[model samples]
Target: MRGYAIRKAMQPHRLTLKVWAVAGSFFGSLCFVLFQGGKLALMLFVIVSILSIYLLLGKWSGIRKTAGSRQLMNAEHETTIEAGSSLNVSMHLQIPGIWPIPYVFVKERLFHKNNTEYTYEVTLVPDWKRRGIFEYKTHPLRRGFYTFGKTECVTEDIFGLFEHTGYIELPQQVAVLPQIVPIREWHQFHQMMKGTNHHSTTTRAVRETTQINGVREYIYGDRLSRIHWNATAKTGTWKSKEFERESLPKTFVVLDRHSQGYTEDEQFELAVSVCASLFHYGASRSFALGLVSGGAASQFFEPKHGQQHLKAVTQHLIGVEADGTYPLRRILKEYVQNVAPGSFVTVISPEHGESMLAVLHWLKQLQLNPCHIFVSADPQRKEHWLKSLKSAGFVGYAVSSLAELPVMLGGRS
Candidate 1:
């Protein structure tokens, strides 16, 4: 591990000892020739040249050691911002000794899940206070989690003949929440219980205990009574009692792309946010959830509940894209045929008219209401779509941004 660390730490710079060796030799030879070819003068010149090379090597080595030993004050710092909101991350770096150097380049290494890397650079100015904070702000272009690790600081010696760099091995993490969340539990409660008091339609077909989800592989800490003997013998492992109705009401969210008219990024982001909100809501109610997306890169996950499925779906959702070349009807028909019967289907899109009508028929065939949640880039157009859905026997809500999603999920009236 240490060897790997050293190589990675050194790989950034194009290091060559040959340059310094040549410089040392050149200075030594010049001094000898200029000093009347005297033996004592030549010896002195050689000694001085050697000392200069040694000093430069020592400085570089010291910087390397300092960097390897340095520690970041915070192991992990979390700052939550609604998607598109600006977020600032501050970090403090401390070293045992201060070099009286004025100019040093500090950089942070970022790793994104989209297989992309980001490097952030800052110039460090000497402060008499000995401690300084570096603040970085980004208008989180995408939601989900982003991580930063292995920071490097580069500085050259005053002579510019040798360069020294330091590495800060700190793990920094930041999470960008979905820009909007549709249908908060609190909002749903108000919608169901407000005024005349209508019951939630999400109730289960079976009146079983809400605590049981389903049988799952047992872990070390699980209780023995939770074990399922029949499943254990069949699977050759301990199977624990799982809850069935512990999750929120089951939701099957579908994306309609035929006429939504979105840029690649906008469509992808909307799909990701919709999936995340459903996962979050399902986890809260212990409800099984599934996702389906239209377009060329079609996807579908069968209705299931658990932390693992949530993570699995989330990873796929981040990269979901719409080819936008195929007819929306094809995707809708596919969703209708593949969706589990009786699961609540929610279609998300800005498109209406034919696409909505097609989705409606599909949902009706499955005997599901299939709520429509339209995320409109334009506020007026979103309102128009909401009214249109209401007239068509489907409840609709408009989300202008991803941030409003959590408000909707939290059950805001």
Candidate 2:
């Protein structure tokens, strides 16, 4: 077992009231034996003193030795998982000592980004080698970054007179990715931009070139001509050469994080899900995707297509919170320089007032195709916003949950 640095200042063995009472009785019996000269009293006092000393010293010495022994603890869990899923964790503890321990109490704590903490307690009975293993499952977790706090192992003597505690620090975290609703066909973009001159510039599908970009695992439908024989022979698996594609159409997803726009946390989560779903759709079709979150700390990513870029975007969404100081109009105006002309911009927010409409108009004037996706749970509000956006010649979608996104974008659920 690996050695762990025990705490320098171990708590001294605690003597409960019973120990003090026994001491007082011994003293009283000794007084009686000395004053009254009773043989039975003297004998009882000697026996009582010896037994008390043996019990107290034995427990104290055992605990002190156990504290200094080699100890190690490890936790196993998934580093990342989808939102609304349960997380399972396994804990293993090793303490090398011969002390007879009745049981060890394990306390676990999980901390969320919002400072919410969940605690679990369990009893572990160590084997002869003083090693213990435990497993636990958490309730369904929401979308966010979660971390495990220090695990506390507490053990006490059989009589419960003395207790000792050791801490195992595990620096582990899990990222719960925002839920993504699969989109079969995204017709809103092309349908709204139809008849516009910029429609010709939009990329509908992946157009491959002869230039080789990289090697990837061979798909079932890949042509034999695209196979990389050298890589396949060396790796003992079919590999296919990936060719470079034509310039992809730039698509930017702007997420609104203004606190006033959302009445509850669920609304903002739905908006985030919408943004993530769009990114997923764009990535699968080879579109250069970017993300712009205008919150307390604004984040901007230029339009790019790659697995690394997608991973970075997903990591950001995992820890995002609604703390924006500015409204949608101001946020767009601040970051307008990063967006390119003739590019598609999708603004996801719950606000659908004149200010939002004006921003969309301004984006159009700047030669950017802008669309609105209003996130809300109220049907009446959604209806009003969709009608207003359509009248202003913009594609708009209303999504209350991830399940409603596919059908709203002209795809079957």
Q: Pick by TM-score: which candidate is best?
A: 2
TM-score for all predictions?
Answer: 0.59, 0.77
Q: Which stretches of candidate 1 lie over 4 Å from their true place?
A: 1-104, 113-116, 122-141, 144-153, 164-250, 256-260, 264-271, 294-298, 318-328, 338-341, 403-413
Model 2 alpha-carbon drift over 4 Å, by segment: 1-19, 25-77, 190-245, 411-413
User: lDDT tens digits, residues 10-94, model 2?
Assistant: 2222244556776787788778788877778789878878766655554443333332121122212447887888877777777
Weakest 10 consecutive residues of candidate 1 by summed lDDT: 189-198
Candidate of highest lDDT:
2
What Cα-based lDDT does every candidate model obtain? 0.61, 0.77
> Whole-model lDDT for model 1 versus the true structure?
0.61
lDDT tens per residue, model 1, 285-324: 5666777766666777777868888767766555455555
* TM-score (C-alpha) between model 1 and the true structure: 0.59
